[model samples]
Target: MPPGTPFTVVYELDDECALELANKTVHGVCHLGWVPAADGDYELRMAVLVKPNGFLGRLYMAGIKPFRYGLVYPAMTRQWESRWRNRNRSGGARPR
Candidate 1:
């Protein structure tokens, strides 16, 4: 992403990464993690943490709750799964 994008990389490691975003209404972190599975594969996990700036921020979060749960999260999961599948097909090594 460009320098001015809302999200900024906080840290990245072999199994996890975090990005932060702050705006007038809210501040948030998006974390993506990978864990070894019992089946000898990796599982992807994601979490979002947010702090509301004030009333507007609280309202904004509430307003987007449905879309976030119903659309955004599912879409993101699909994209990640696709990338993982493609990587395996191409014999790409997992990020470390």
Candidate 2:
């Protein structure tokens, strides 16, 4: 997450971070976690929880579902992956 994004960081820890967003249409929280793998590596996991404000809100969420899945999420994943790859080169700088 960047400075100008709509989401506000609720909390962050070594292995997890939670970001929240609220608007007329919905309130949502996005959680990112790093899970330990059996092979002694870590995998990134994401979960989003949303609450619709009303009928219109529900409709809005439904409408954006396709875009979110087809475009937004994939792009975000790529960006994160790139960041992760460059982290060591950058002296392990934390993601902002």
Best by TM-score: 2
**Model 2 CA lDDT for position 44:** 69
The residue ranges of model 2 lying beyond 4 angstroms of the native Cα positions read 92-96
lDDT of 1: 0.79
TM per candidate comes to 0.75, 0.78
After superposing candidate 1 on the true structure, give the runs of residues whose Cα lies further than 4 Å from its correct spot: 1-5, 80-96
Per-residue C-alpha lDDT of model 1 across residues 4-90, encoded as one tens digit per residue: 657788996656778898999999998877777789877778898999999999999999999999998788766765665466567
Question: How badly does each model clash, as a count of residue pairs?
Answer: 0, 0
lDDT of each: 0.79, 0.79
Q: What lDDT does candidate 1 reach at residue 49? A: 93
